[model samples]
Target chain A: MSEQLATVTGLYGLLAEFREPEQVVAAARAARSAGYRRLDAYSPQPVEGLAEAIGHRTSRVALLVLVGGVVGCLSGFALQYWTMGVAYPINVAGRPLNSWPAWVPVMFELTVLCGALAAVLGMLGLNGLPMPYHPLFHVRRFEAATRNRFFLCIEARDPLFDREATQSFLERQKPLEVYEVPW
Target chain B: MTPPDHVATQAAAHSSVQPPDAPPPVLEPGHTLSTVTDKISSIVLTAPPPRSWYFGLAISFALVMLLMWTITQLLWRGVGIWGINIPVGWGFDIVNFVWWIGIGHAGTLISAILLLLRQTWRTSINRFAEAMTLFAVACAGLYPLLHMGRPWFFYWLIPYPNTMGLWPQFRSPLVWDVFAVSTYASVSLLFWYVGLIPDLATLRDRSRHRLGRKVYGMLAMGWRGSALHWHRYETAYLLLAGLATPLVISVHTVVSFDFAVGQVPGWHTTIFPPYFVAGAIFSGFAMVVTLAVPLRAVYGLQDFITERHLDNMAKIMLATGWIVAYGYAMEAFLSWYSGSPPEEYVLVNRMFGPYRYQYWALLACNIAVPQLMWSRTVRRTGWMLFIVSILINVGMWQERYIIVVTSLHRDFLPSSWGMYHGTKWDWSMFAGTIGLFLALLFVFLRLLPMISIFEMRTLVEEEKHVHGGHSDTSDPRGPAP
Candidate 1:
């Protein structure tokens, strides 16, 4: 608990605000090249190159949704087969008990349902959302990151992070302002 | 620093590729990111509700109360209160069910299908259109539940373990409808909510009031516009759009199966699936235009929901309208060509039967009225399109009525055949659902950013690119030099 508390209260990052998305992307690339592995960028809208600059390229959401769809499809068909073919089977014109054609629509619906559920749940899980508290929220001006400003932050947890050195490096990118984000 | 003269020359050269009157700008003039945030957010966060809003809300609330009253009486009485009987077992309830569900198709088409196709104009209208889908589905859902008479036993539709050891018949189209409609509602709600998160975060940040900030903050779900979040967000959004695109085709096809799987002459045709899908989109676009015209005028949002958006939507309606017209022609031609007396008789009855006027009116409203859109002027004129949309809405409803009642009323045995006329209860229920739809819409406009703020910002970015400004030249995953 004490270790966790120490981590929580520790210095979070040094944040630099840039006037343009290009500057943020350039700064992120510079920070990555300078051996800072734990870094992030924020902008009013998606800046094309910022994700790659921060080295976040691939996501597992599609794979999760595909797995969900397959599961949903199998389960849906299985449930119908069990109910119709085994439990309380009423002979409807002596048709086959396991009517696969009859099972397609429900299976399709369930596939979509699970696929959609996976999309939302996987996205939230991957993004770590509903976290109302974060160290970055400590900076009042950071709110503008959702409006007009662009920001790049280098985390203190990075092996090469030194408060003074990181501050100087971000300053070299010619940002509008630099601030230490506190826990 | 960039030279002003050089920028102007470049901008001029770019504009030269398009016709003299390049499409009206997607967004209004003089909008910086800050101004965009301020203008849209202020509508929800700061501006007082206009008197017109209050007036409309009151009327809608009154109608909703009437709906509640009718529903209460319906529960107290029974399905006997409806006009459905004899050969015409389905009445206004089914017609309205199909109508409301059809109205929702345009939203999915606009938001999901258009997004996949990379149509940027969808950004302006997708948010509100998705909301309309949710509300329309809600209204559509009310019919089947209430039409069952014992609304409390509606859970019987679900595949749950019961002491009675019964399961929903898998082969029945009615059962398929339960899955289709419910899945549509769930997916649409999630898609709408997922799209709202970023804009909600914007609302969270811009709101000055503590209570407003807290409310929007909770809804925003701690979004900070991080690049990592956007990466996952874009992926999830694309996946959902892909998933929803199939649903836009499938859900209505399943709905159409409820009729096609039957043995009735008009309902049993193989063409029902594609025909129903086309009609759904046709009516759905009409409803969008119907709602958008009044909405843009009321809110003075002519800049955001511009003439071009309406024009584009009108063009879609025109195309889909032709498809619906083709369905009608094919229905007539196939009935005659099949040489099946019962099928031929149904078509002849539809034209010259007791409901002859309705058939003609349906064609006039659905087919003839939309022909006005061939003229660019009518499509661009908001009022003209709005009136046309109202006509199409009425026509679509009558089309459903003709398909359901006319066929059922004159089925094989003349002795069992009977006419269906809507009672006051029917009108009340229909009006009530409309009231519910409108009230929900008004609340959504009041509380949410009807247009996506972040997406409109992307449009601004593109506009800057056209003007030879800081172009977004880097790939989404590549580093800047």
Candidate 2:
């Protein structure tokens, strides 16, 4: 593989979106056909076929939750065993060395604590919360994502992300307007 | 091009004042008592009562009052009037406390969790569930206060720096209950308030009387529904929902700590928290169904709280019922597996002991009976569903009693064992609590709009926006466009 450190400057990508979901889908298909890979789409709400247009599988949220729960369960068991059996083992009324029964409540509680913590932290981590900064924020009308606007963006990161080619593809979509993004 | 300009010009020509592009102004024989009553009457007249609604309400109200008077007498005389003795000091009070608290959990789940999930059907039932939660919690909060014997010094439960340099023991489960219940109530109130503001605005816009306008205007908080305001409001509501979802689970988990961390054989277990939470939600749904089934008929909100809503609540009850069943099975399994003689005995007594009837009642109500709802037809039938809900509530209450009273009745030593038989006062006090809960609910029904108007409007708006120009049959989702 020839790892050429290619650098290009003074190149900007423009994004335009159609109000109709079908039009957005058609434009996305056209862009992909036009070899634009580094693209993103935003809608006020989740559109039926937009996930396929963006070319991503199901969200990684479930994976995060699964990993969190497993880790939580393990730590819960480990912590209770360590505290009760090893740390300060007070043999109260001839209870066993590995007293699993006594450990039950704390283990359960810690499991919930860790599982809940994982959900909060995992959600934040996945969503990139407290982000305060994003290139999308630079777009004046991007605030409409929470309201009544649908949008699509083609980043300059894709191998075929040529400024002129991306702009031409978006213009053919016949959206409200096409704007250049300075990332 | 400008609709407002045309309307304004037309109003000027007619010599009648009308705000252009604004909602119609409310005008009538406004401020007088008769006018206000008339306005209320119009809404009431259109309201259709169920065939047997009056009988149900009268009975529930009567029983509730009986419970209240019983409690009042218990509070006045002393905690000694009950049959709780020796090891079984908890008896009916603690059992009732946990029972009521569990009944309160479903309300929060419907409002907060469903809101976060973007479940639109939640709008119809959420308001009544929330009101149920507040009232049930009020009922739940009482048992612990009265159970404390000297209820007046309940202020000491609040953690504070005192003149005598005393601070509450945060480590204790009872202390945790104080914080948990207080925080739950306060947050639940905030959640209810935030959801109500938009509906209040709708009421304000629709009011035709001066008192109606004044009352709703104050509640509406001068909302103009600007895009930015809606944006911020949605964000805030979502954020609050996020906060509340875990809080619901946590509050009940903490409540379970009162039992699970104890040294008692039946009480000490890992499954109690989830078990308790599940049972709470199960009972809560049953209570909501108990209230809403008749309410929709009485209030003429069949379009709002349709059979679909009843079907959903019944499904939820069934789901939670499975959880309760699983928890009970696990407890029995753990007891047998643990190889602890005392734990083994505790499980045995629970199944076939003196209070075996209570145990079977719980199993039948919380687990077996709800299975009938698996058939959609039964769930959709209001009277059938209502009967099941009432039974579930009874079973859940008895389950709590069995857990708290029966377990503690024979603790640590066999010599200290004592069977708890509630006196007449005990029964009356329990009855009194029902009355108090209903009285609060009665006032709430009259004062507030029982159904959420704003959430309904949002659903309508979303429907319109999605199918702007398409044929009704074109939409793939349920009920088409």
Question: Which candidate leads in lDDT?
Answer: 1
lDDT tens digits by residue: candidate 2, A50-118: 657656555444455456557755765675455456654566688575766544433444444444344
- Candidate 1 deviates by what RMSD? 4.9
Q: lDDT by residue for model 1 over A48-153, one digit each (tens)?
A: 9889999987889989999989998999999888988898687889888888898899999999999999999999999999999999999999999989899999
Would candidate 1 be rated incorrect, acceptable, medium or high by CAPRI criteria? high
Q: After superposition, how far is residue B275 of candidate 2 from its true place, in Å?
A: 0.7
Model 1 CA lDDT for position B318? 93
Model 2: fnat (fraction of native contacts): 0.00
**Second chain TM-score for model 1:** 0.94
Error of 1 at B217 (Å): 0.9
* Candidate 1 regions with alpha-carbon error over 4 angstroms: A1-9, B1-21, B469-481
Q: Write one digit per residue (lDDT tens) for candidate 2, span B1-481.
A: 7999999986564453333433211111012222222233334233343445455557668877687676667678888888878888888888888888877888999998998888778876888788888888988898888888888899988644567655554335776677667667766776787677655654554556678767766775554332223433454456556656877887788889899879898999999999999988989999999998877777665656777788888988999999999999999999899898988988889889998999998999888899999987788889999999999999998888888877888776898888888888788877777877776776666567676655654454455554454424432232312
Residue B233 alpha-carbon offset, candidate 2, angstroms: 1.4
Distance from true location, Cα of B65 in model 2, Å = 5.5
Q: Give candidate 1's whole-model lDDT.
A: 0.90
On residues B234-333, what C-alpha lDDT tens digit does candidate 1 reach at each position? Answer: 8899999999999888999999999999998888888999999999999999999999998888888887898889889999999999999999999999
Q: Report model 2's TM-score to 2 decimal places.
A: 0.66
Clashing pairs in 1: none
